[model samples]
Target: MFGPFRLTSPLSGGLLWKIPWRMSRPQKARQRARLRHVDKVVSIVDQALAKKGTTTAAVERWKAEMPVEQEMLPRDKYTIFDRKEKKYRKGIHKLPKWTRVSQRLNPPGY
Candidate 1:
């Protein structure tokens, strides 16, 4: 966008700034939604960390705070529906809390 025509003689040169492109309404809305979701997660994590006290706490404390490592067993087959995917998830509650697992960590109720 910055071409030779953008340039001017010293007499005509004061400032030649480029105007930034703005997002469309839909794009802006989507970005705002994503930001809100991220902010919500950050706030929850901050609160959890604060409530958990020191970084080096007891094993029991860590166990009480962290999410379980096992797959969640839903009470019913159709506990939740994913709107974005446009599909019905059966036994959705039977999903795991943590994507990764270790021998030590497990879900709270598990």
Candidate 2:
């Protein structure tokens, strides 16, 4: 029953490749908003440092200005538990106290 069967060639056109899709407009906008907030915080910190002329005061002010709800957390909330040493130690210090003392001794270091 293969009478009058005709062979057809495959269609040729532009390449067809799968591409990864991207976020919708609303999702993109929300992401941009979050980035903007981060940028604002950075700018605020930078401006405070520049205007205060002293890192310690700027940091103290920043801490004082933080929301009270954040302050409710235990002082050692971020402290690391030294299992071997059996003590709670501060995690990486953002601005160690020694740095301030050293800067006082050598203002140029600041």
Candidate 3:
């Protein structure tokens, strides 16, 4: 008794949302710009704090641990490590809120 009146499933199987396999060139450019802006902001803050003759542990740790934009390899800047992904890497954009979050590091030798 299957007909338009019969109810089982309203939709067939298919991908509801498709994510791009990789980022476009313009997106990469924008990502780089954002990285540079973050670096600039950090340096500005450090300078301002120095002028005031004070430094916070957070600022010191950031400078000690994070490599500035110029020092990061393009691979590290644009991709992140994922154990399930082929070649153990996936595009940064694959992560939710990637633009707003800083993903500047991966496991060493990943």
- Candidates 2 and 3 compared: the better one by lDDT is 3
TM-score of each: 0.30, 0.31, 0.85
Candidate 3: Cα lDDT at 107 = 92
User: What are the RMSDs of all candidates, in order?
Assistant: 18.1, 22.3, 6.2
lDDT of 1 by residue, 1-110 (tens): 36766645533667543422233466435534443454466456656777987333444454464333222232221233334333343223223441122223222332
Identify the candidate with maximal lDDT. Answer: 3
Give the least accurate 10-residue stretch of model 2, judged by summed lDDT: 101-110
Error of 1 at 37 (Å): 1.2
Give Cα-based local distance difference scores for all models.
0.39, 0.38, 0.90
Against the true structure, candidate 3 reaches a TM-score of: 0.85
What's the C-alpha lDDT at position 35 in model 3? 95
- lDDT of residue 67 for candidate 1: 34
Which residue pairs overlap in candidate 3's backbone?
A: none
Better of 2 and 3 by TM-score: 3
The Cα error of candidate 2 at residue 54, in Å, is: 4.0
Runs of candidate 2 exceeding 4 Å displacement: 1-20, 55-110
